[model samples]
Structure formats: C-alpha cells, structure tokens
Target: MRLGSVIKVKPEKLEEYKRLHRNVWPDVLKTIKACHISNYSIYYKDGFLFSYYEYKGNDYHQDMAKMAADPKTKKWWAVTDPCQSPIETRNEGEWWAAMEEVFHLD
Candidate 1:
C-alpha cells in the first residue's frame, strides 16, 4: 500500500530538518523497515513537506502502533516533531495530514 502526507516545516527548522534526514539514525531506519515501510521519501517546498512511503505489511494500524511504541522512534520524534507544524486540516492526533490518491497508474 502507498501512503502520503503533508506537513508544514518551520522556516527556521528547515535546514536542520534536512540535515537530520540526510543521515537518519541506523537504528531508526531499521525500525522503519521493521515496521514494513519502504521507499520512504520526504520532499520540501516553500516550508511544506510531502512524505511518501509504501507499506508491505498487512496490519497497517497495528504496525503503526508498534512503530509509535518503539523507544528509539519516540526519541527520534522528539527531535523531528518540533520542526513540523501540522496543518490545520489535520484531524485530531494526526501529525501529518493524510492525502487522497486521486490517480495512480502502474
């Protein structure tokens, strides 16, 4: 499955965020792969970040919960979350505003 989301990046934190993403921790990458996420990418434009990733797991929510529960992942978020400003359109408890895939051809 494919997933995508959008979030606002604070202007001041943009460069730092990019630098962090450039060399995400090895353990963190392993955790993400363990959660069945692949082809993950984040693009930036005008202070907005667009993220996309593919899920190979059957249980999406459960895997997400597991990812969220990981200690290292939690620590990672502590540093990254401060750089993001979730859009107003994001629902309660959502850090990234999920997007609808209007079209896809493969």
Candidate 2:
C-alpha cells in the first residue's frame, strides 16, 4: 500500500532537519525495514515535508504499532520531532497529516 503524509518544518531548522535525515541512524533504518516499509522518501519544499512510503506488510496498523513501540525509533523521533511543526490541518491525533491519493497509474 502507498501512504503519504505531510508536516511542516520550522523555518529555522530546515537545514538541520535535512542534515539529520541525510544521516538517519542505522538502527532506525533497520527498524523501518523490519516494519515492512520500503521505498520511503521524504521531500522538502516551502518549509513543508512530505513523506511517502510503500507498506508491504500484511497488517499496516500492526506494523506501524510495532515500529512505534521500538526504543530506537522512539529515540530518533525525540530528536526529529523538535524540528517539525505538526500542521494545523492534521487530524486530532496525527503529527503528520494523512494525505489522500488523488491519482495514480500503474
């Protein structure tokens, strides 16, 4: 399944955010893969960060829950979350607002 989300980057921390992502920790990467998330990529523009990833797991919620329950992933988010501003448009419980798939071919 293809998933997408959007969040805002604090203007002052854009460079630092990019730098941190450029060197994402190995354990974090491993955890993500272990969760069956692939083809994950984050793009930045106009102070907004958009993330897209393909979930190849049998259960999306379970996989995501597993990832969230990981210690290393928690540490990683502690560092990264400070640089982000949850968009106001996001749902009540979402740090990154879920985006709808408008169109896709193939």
Per-model TM-score versus the true fold: 0.97, 0.97
Mind giving the per-residue lDDT tens digits that candidate 2 earns over 1-106?
9999999999999999999999999999999999999999999999899999999999999999999999999999999999999999899989999999998887
lDDT of 1 by residue, 49-88 (tens): 9999999998999999999999999999999999999999
Mark the 10 consecutive residues where model 1 has the least summed lDDT. Answer: 97-106
Model 2 lDDT at residue 95: 94
Off by over 4 Å in 1: none
C-alpha lDDT (0 to 100) for residue 8 of candidate 2: 96
What global local distance difference test value does model 2 have? 0.95
Q: Score residue 34 of candidate 2 by CA lDDT.
A: 97
RMSD per candidate (Å) reads: 0.6, 0.7
**lDDT for residue 75 in candidate 1, whole number 0-100:** 96
Which stretches of model 2 miss by more than 4 angstroms? none
Worst 10 residues of 2 by lDDT: 86-95
